[model samples]
Target chain A: MTGWLGSLRERAARITPGTLLVRGAAFVFAAGALLVAFPGEILLWPGAAVALVACGAAPALAPRTRLTTMVLFLAVGGWIVATTTYAEPVTWARLATLACLLYLVHTTAALAAVVPYDTVVAPAVLVRWLARTAVVLALTVGFAVASVVGVRVVSGQAYLVAAVAGVLLVAALAGLLTLSRRS
Target chain B: MADGSLGGAGDEDGWVPTRAFGRAILVVGVLVLLAALTGRYDLVVLAAPFALGTALSLRRRPAALPAPELSTMDARIVEGDDFAVRVSVANPDPVALDLVLVRLWLPRWVRVRDADHPYAAPVAAGSVAEIDLSGTALRWGRHDVGPLSLHGVACDGLLVSLRVECEPLPIKAYPATDPFRADEAMPRAAGLVGQHHSRKPGEGGELAGVREFSPGDRLRRIDWRVTLRTRRVHVVSTLSDRDAEVVLLLDVLHEAGESGGTGGAASVLDTTVRAAAGIAEHYLHRGDRVAMLEYGFRARRLRPATGRRQYLTVLEWLLDAKPAGGADQPSTGAFGAHLLSANALVIVLTPLLDQRSAAMVAGLARSGRFVVAVDTLPPSLRPPTDGAWGPLADRVWRMSRENVIGLLREHGVPVVGWAGAGSLDHVLRDVTRLASAPKVGRR
Candidate 1:
């Protein structure tokens, strides 16, 4: 694991700015695809578009500008969640779209922090970053799909409690991973 | 000057969190935990990306951090010569390094030619990335090149490794030599064997005269035709070529004007060392014994020696010598009189900035020692002022300098500006002529 991670870090160093832009575009496209997949939240379209653009263009913007954009993006995300809370029942598609948007923000910010504004990123490195983020998103979507199927079969507060338990389980698994990394 | 080796292995082999990493953790932790408490499935989805990223980044640990190695082709060079330095950082683990920034510390004497000083480059995992640092050495001195700082980041800046520091490299640039040469013959010759023709008749290649053969004369010396015509045992007598000692007295008390090194303004000391080197090489090449004496705050000497090897030895001493006294305090006369050989031609190289050095030249002249003071001061130097008093002060300085030279002329010491080859020809010829003329002795 150490050797594998070391190699990946070494490869990351070789990434250029061009590759960064391409990967960032892909992340933004993935977010747009999520918006299209869950068209039930019409109000989220403009907010999602703005957040994606802000995050995608973060590298080119000044640090202060990016900071402001991030703050605004978080506010919009909170509003979207609040507005959709009472509109309809939470479905697997809505959950998947939310997951994709969250991952897109994380990936965009991470890439922006790594490379400067003017640097030309290597293609292979950007692809590697995208591939890793995609794997995580796919896994999260798979969990949501499984939960939705389980809720359909057994509808009640019991299933909701189970869903909460599942969230706790994933959180605990993440904590354990962090602890192992520290050691 | 920092040395090349930075810190121990223990300090360099670890992962450290950057500000970005910390921010990521904070944002992920707060948002996800809030969503879990409220039991909002949509909010939980919103927090999933950060948690996954944090978990994945921390789950796999990288091996030892990259180690940097800095090297250069040549440490010792002449002024105006450019040298190439190679900086290679080695990654032992398979993790690709996304970003690596290296900042090098260079002395003022060196200027980078082709690239920016603080370099940034990318390195693939488990490989070495080399960067070229090309620069020209501007001056002659001992300089240090580095103790470079390296910043490495992996996993798209999510993971930043500990900064690595390297050591400094030492470089020495030697002074350039002028084109001055010395005369083949001296006024007086003391060594038995040399290349210069002497007045005294003896066994040599050049014909001196045809005279009656004297006892102890070699049979080969007898000129048969002269003996037959004069009805006597005449032998071919040739003038013996003897080597003479040339002592270079360098006045290192004061150095005036700016020194720009190669292709630039020459300071008094710059021209002085170059002229000294040229004279030494000229005399040494002609099989004449050469010695050097530097008098400033302290005196240093290289005993009279002959051969090409001793030229390098003399140059080494010249390189190490510096004008000791500051401009405020005039240098005292500290001539190495004990190191002088009898009838040695004393060529004093000085800018004549102080009266003490001028008086020393006068004393050497009065003692009947053949002396020549080569003016090492550049004539094109301007006074350090832009106002009306600038030209006035410069004129006053020049007038005083001329008066000093006139005094040396009165004492029969010829003062000449260094003009490369044949710079000492006329003065040496005058010394030879004076040696033959009759002079009044002390009462």
Candidate 2:
């Protein structure tokens, strides 16, 4: 009993205020992305959103696992299914917001995995991480907007362009992986 | 150190890709393929950040591993004194490290505040990040500060370097000497010159007697008052102020009770060591030669010397006085001759836990040594109280130990329980008187 209590106390000491904030941000972003995907449904009442919210909140429990990736993909898959099946209007602003939220979830969860619970993290580390994340989000939005405007300029068959764009994107991803392996 | 569990080092030397990197590629590929087949162009917005972020982060992989340096104060420090262990992790690569994780390992005797947990910090390119862990050492001994483990996480946790280990630093924590003062003369003065006064009449500060003027007696020593009173030429005589040799005999045959360190409850070894240090410091400061000897299997000894340097050496010797099995009578008797001087005062610090310690004390006294047996067992220590006869057993043990102490004292060895300052004064006074008395010569 004493050993158990001591281990508990040891684990408790490892939780710092900074760790709490990062984990809290991970949970909020995950739950928020899922909620935004399913509009007009109560957070607790909807079966699909609640289940996806649980998956999103997995990072709060164990951020270092592949669970965070699973949650992000599940929420995106849910969003894609809801939009296409129900014929909801796909606004670029909504897409961008969802994109930022999903990215934020990934960024925060990744930070949580590396930083120990009891770490005396320097303020500059978090500030710099947030700054980098902001830069990435802004640049992503710029490239996204440019792609959208460029696609609008093309007249005629949208599905044909989508097929070509998707193939190119897949090829680019495969190339990135290959290059990363070499580096 | 990089454990094999961390996949050791790859062809990149230190860098290992993280789960986030693989997740990014997989998620981006799946989303774009699904969007292309489903004819939904807006899905590209969701996939854009993952692709862009991974691409930008991977643009720079650290070419060199982080360097971790651990440093501590190497000089000897007293127990319970606050000390700091400095740890610095330097990033030599051009890429800024997103996070650096550091873990510290310390000996059981050391208590570094908040160092029980790992630390994380950021080091910019070609810069160093430092963490100072400060705390008190709780006991006396040679201890290691840390074998600090360090690793760097860069590219937003997409990659990590293999652990960089810094070797542990040896720190000698000397026992904290208690305030001990003995307001009595040493029983014997065996050395040529120092603080304690000797019996023989000589040129010194302590007056021995007033006698009639004799040949070779300097006029400066002439006592006018004594000459006038006696109506004869008289001179003041003084005892020679010679140093004494104090041999601290630590009985390391048995160690009893728990060592709670410094301010906590002391065990037999703790009491013995602290008392020995205090006693040595007191006599050494007063210009007396101090020596040390262990009675266990090792039977280590330090020669008698008077100085600040000997005091430090004595503390160093005390750290190695761990308990071992008993030395046979013949071995103990053989060492008794060389390790002891004719007029040296022997202070034996023992727990008196068994017959061997009591026999050793008796043997020293029988050998005509002016031996003082200091009972070093903590007063609060008690036997196990778990079974039906626990209290009874404890009572019997106490009675037995008291009997041994009684026997030792009856054999002319002064057995006294160690209390700080002035604890040995009465016994020392009696021993000094005994030394001044006449004794029969052994043929």
Candidate 3:
């Protein structure tokens, strides 16, 4: 498992600086388009943009950039959950959710294209990209849905959902680690 | 020669902390102050110190480092053997460096097995650090060993270190050849001269035939006393002296084993080297003066001599020879000059990969010198294509070999296809038989 992780890190290092800039630009453009489409919705516009930029640009940057992007993505997700609990259905919220979904697909494709495959291929690379995209998508949808239902789920339920998601993701990673070791 | 200068003639000595830890503390303190002032608490807490540490780790100043000088300890090394390369780093600064990182880049053919120091260490001022590196010679030829890079840092991670560029060193790896075994028997030509005694009679020295004395015959060769016993006037005919010179021509243009085989130990070049070594050693043992010429990137010659030492020298030369690139092919005039007066039995060991080499060999054979070509091509490395270009190229090569053989045969030269496996003796015998036959007219 450590070997797989190390290989993944090496592949990340090999990505050229130019490729990172181009992918980042594309993600920023998509985020800008999302913000323009959903004008007044405070939660939808900024949150979707941040999530999209993070997902697209994470693979291209150095270790520092990847960590920063992930942190920004988590912060934006937390803000969306906090803000949407008291708000009613807005067209902009629905549009923002749709925009986030589309951005996720675009970012995944962009990241996959730049991943260096010359050396050893590891499962962690695919798993990490998929897990990140899935988590962001799930959070965006859950918060948007909570906003729509007109029933404010307690902060305790939100924490419970987050805990379960974290455990499942860990289990999946552990399973992958064990499978890789056996092979 | 100024005060406060780093390494000039006139400077006062002072205790300066060159530790990386001290530098890191300074950077952390700056970051704490910046965080306190900016109120960007999250970024100041998360990024500042890590950023500082990374910058410190990769920091290098151009002027503060010592330049490294590289010299070849041993230029030529034999394949499968260990050899040393030395590099000297001189520190001109008055203040000592805490840690120094020396990174040496090696060529593709050379593999580093061991070194004196594998990691960074401290070096004092006005001192030189001489590093001795040892590695196995993985391939033959002239290889560049290093442009040794030096990275020095203080013990405290506050400031960026030093970076210096060093000169490159050349290492030549020679080919390895063993002594020839006497048990291996090769066919001996009749009436051939110098040291080996032959049973057949010839025109000088040994009495070969008894015939009636001709009018112009030397009186000393006449049997004058035979007249007294009613014998006819007779004369003694002696065998003529014949000295055969053997020239071993090695084809070093290209090596054969690029294509991976299912399972095999030796490549085509290995087989060729062994065969050439065997033949050259055999000739040298027989009191025959033997010379060697290598045809690769450039042509090299070792003049013919008969002795154990001469044979060893030739073997050593062969081991170190490398294949030259296609651009290095000699001019027509140079090729002509090299082969013009070569009267010895020229034994060419080659894989016959290109047309230029084949043409040159054919040209030499056509010039009436005794030529024997030992083709080193294995069947496995041939391209597996059925198209016109592929088949045509293969056929062209095959035809070139055949044409060379035919040309040599027309000039009474021998051509042997030594595939380096199975029965080499049989191949030699067959080639010898063909060589001995009357010359065939060229088509």
Lowest lDDT sum, 10 consecutive residues, model 2 chain B, at B1-10
Query: TM-scores for chain B, in order?
Result: 0.84, 0.93, 0.61
**Which residue pairs in model 2 clash with each other?**
none
Q: Per-residue alpha-carbon lDDT of model 2 for B275-355, expressed as tens digits?
A: 999999999999888889888777788999889999989999988878776444337454574568978899999989869
Q: For candidate 3, lDDT tens digit of each residue in B149-258?
A: 76553322122243466766877665444334332223334235665333345545766777787787777887666644557878776755445467777777776666
Q: What docking grade does candidate 3 earn?
A: incorrect
Candidate with maximal TM-score: 2
The best-first sequence of candidates by lDDT reads: 2, 1, 3
Q: What is the TM-score of each candidate against the true structure?
A: 0.75, 0.92, 0.49
Per-prediction fnat: 0.23, 0.57, 0.00
Which stretches of model 2 miss by more than 4 angstroms? A1-13, A39-52, A155-157, A160-183, B1-12, B225-231, B325-334
TM-score of chain B of 1: 0.84
Indicate the residue-level lDDT of B317 in model 2. 94
Please give, for residues B157-235, the per-residue lDDT of candidate 1 as tens digits. Answer: 5566666898877777766767766554688888778888887786567788888887899998889998888898998
Q: Per-model i-RMS in Å?
A: 6.5, 3.2, 17.7
Higher-ranked by lDDT: 2 or 3: 2
**Candidate 3: clashing residue pairs, number:** 22
